[model samples]
Target chain A: MAGTDDRDVRLVAYADGELDEDAARAVEAELATSAEARRLLGIHRETASLLKAAFPESRYAGGSLPPAPAGRARPGPHLLARPWAGAVAASLLLGCIGYGAGSLWPAPIAAGPSRMLAEIAEYHALYSRETRHLVEADASEAEHIRAWLGPKVGRAIAIPDLSAAGLTFAGARLVALEGQPVAALMYTRPDGLPVAFCILSAPAAGRGMLQAEREGVGVASWGDGTHRYVVVGEAPPERLRHWVGLVQRQI
Target chain B: MADESFRQALTRLLPRLRRFGMTLTGSGTDADELVQTTCERVLGRAGQLRDDTRLDAWLYAVMRNLWTSELRRRRIRRHEGIEAAEAVAGEDGAARTEDRMTLAAVRRAMDSLPEEQRAVLMLVCVDGLSYRDVSAIMDIPIGTVMSRLSRARQDLHARLAGEADGKVTPLRPARRG
Candidate 1:
């Protein structure tokens, strides 16, 4: 009982200045008489100082890396942004795939929906389950998001209102796909299921909404005069189609 | 421009975040990568972070969550090839060459700790975070944070005194039949 874990916790918390004033004064009074309490407190404080000393402040800031915007892998700039805009949606089948997220599928360097799915599978990897990190740009600032991404994506992107489909816009971010920038918009259902809608830039390959499934994830894609839209997630087939219809009509 | 405030906070916290990342990942490149990803997540989710929250604590929480997610991806030693961890302090100066040895011992004792203990130690002892802040960051209760810190400090003292890295050279061995 003299040196129990419960006793040590109070002593340690006091030493670390974590206890409130009253608790700390109690620890201090107990420590004033017992050499053992003083000794343990000293040891913990010494260890704390040692940890701080070993890692000095600003050790990395004295003219080191200038805040690299990101350290994620990026390919050469020469590689052009491709037409199939839905790079990340194909991997959003996380609810159904039930495997690990961000698994690198060795999709060969080809074109069209298959290639885009493989390229941006990583977006869904980190988009795994963090509700907050579901997107880069908050949906509240829809106008600014459109302004920032439209030019870079080389198309007039639309922020479709998916509220009728019971989906709320989360946010959007520009993701790289096959060495090109693609816009990935995120929405979530009340049940906390996340769905990604990606719009890619390309020429007039006009079509209406079409339904398909790839790699166990539901996909609905359509191409307009300037971009291809894809909505991907793991949902009932008809439900996926219904959400796709909502996006199609709004955009 | 929308993320201006978050970006400034991130820049201010880069060193500490990177140090914490290094302690967890044990590689400079890996730590920087982890920090950058954490930064992106923080700025990306800037909406979720209310003005009342401390940015430093939020950055740490995001980084810790990212590291945890990565652990699910690859299961192995979290601080692999960390023998070079002490080399980071070498730039402090050459005047205290002996103190550098002490630093190395301290670092080794730290790494030898269980992951849970070491993480709590770094958060509480090194970062000077209150137990409550550490609890919020680690998502554990305040009492748990205190016990872990107590255990980690005690373990570090025991290890560095004579048991670990030949720090004391064992005058006559510390075992008995």
Candidate 2:
């Protein structure tokens, strides 16, 4: 153990880049003299790199983020009020006619769809295990749930039949996503794990299916420009995707 | 800080927190939960955050405390132990490709490490925290941080290279020289 500690102490300094000049020089001398020291240092470097590779930061891009309550209003759009000013200036400078400045510069991109899924996953993790206050509309009352949510959500709300996927409709609720009302449908497997479908009225941007895992909850979201749908569950990705496929065809 | 700025700042730090959490929990799901809980706690107690400049370290410490509490709760409950197979990447075919096999093996090896060592290694190696920073975040002596980090790397090497036989002896206690 003493020998192991000595080897580790030298290698840790080298691996962590924390050695002072004298300590570093001494360690370098030892490395040149001893193959075992050199091998250990090599292993330390490899392990650090491998750990970073194994768990890259990007994997947690939208991980388990709570739904932000609401953002404050942006500073007024005085610039947007004068739309033709930029276009007129550009056309005069470039000596071109009909120079549409709106098309000249691209619009800023909104939050990515992955964020929506992460928010949904956060809710899923928070509420899946609850016995009460789970939903505003219980799936046991399927007729009432559909009738209540359909018109309010600004779309025809149908609880997709997932019996083929070994899940049953548990209930439905209305929740806010990004300050907009969204329809949330809950399903449960035989083992009682709750699954949720969060539907939002979003602009038609065909951001195909986006899937992610947050805190053990799996989320898959897709949109057809008019409405976006997210399915949150504890099931495997393929299973969630399979359920989403069926829902997509029906809804 | 303003609520909006605080939220935005906290949002930007999510990836790092999640990565640190992934090391602590050794499960993506638990790590995400840890991140979520940390965010919630931070948002709930925004007024108490005296040093906005040290927000990152403060968040790390909050997450560490929450995880420690969770570990204690799980110990008292004696919950089912984590499965070794769950240490692999999530259940996505795209994520489970042959190219990720090395990562999977490394993750499995990391999962075998003691939670303390894994936490220290990630803070020092991945987050690039100094031993002093790690000591502050982990609330341990600097010497202990170094030894734990060193042991963590050694254990990782042994397990990855197939030199270890499952059991690792504890290092000597930390003391000022």
Best by DockQ: 2
My TM-score estimates for the predictions, one after another, are: 0.53, 0.54
lDDT of 2 by residue, A102-165 (tens): 2211111111122333455556677777758677777788889878787766788878888888
Per-candidate clashes, comma-separated: 1, 6
Worst 10 residues of 1 chain B by lDDT: B168-177
What would the DockQ be for model 1?
0.14
Candidate 2 residue-wise lDDT at B159:
71
Q: Candidates' DockQ values?
A: 0.14, 0.17
Which pairs of residues collide in model 2? A139-A171, A203-A225, A204-A225, A205-A225, A215-B29, A216-B29
lDDT of each: 0.61, 0.60
What is the fnat value (0 to 1) for candidate 1? 0.32
Clash pairs, candidate 1, are: A85-A200
Cα lDDT of model 1 by residue, B9-54, tens digit: 6677777886777666554433544565565455545677777787
lDDT of 1 by residue, A132-213 (tens): 6777789887888899888877887788889998888888888776576768888888774688888777433223233445
What TM-score should be assigned to candidate 1? 0.53
Question: Over 4 Å off in model 1, which ranges?
Answer: A1-3, A62-251, B81-83, B163-177
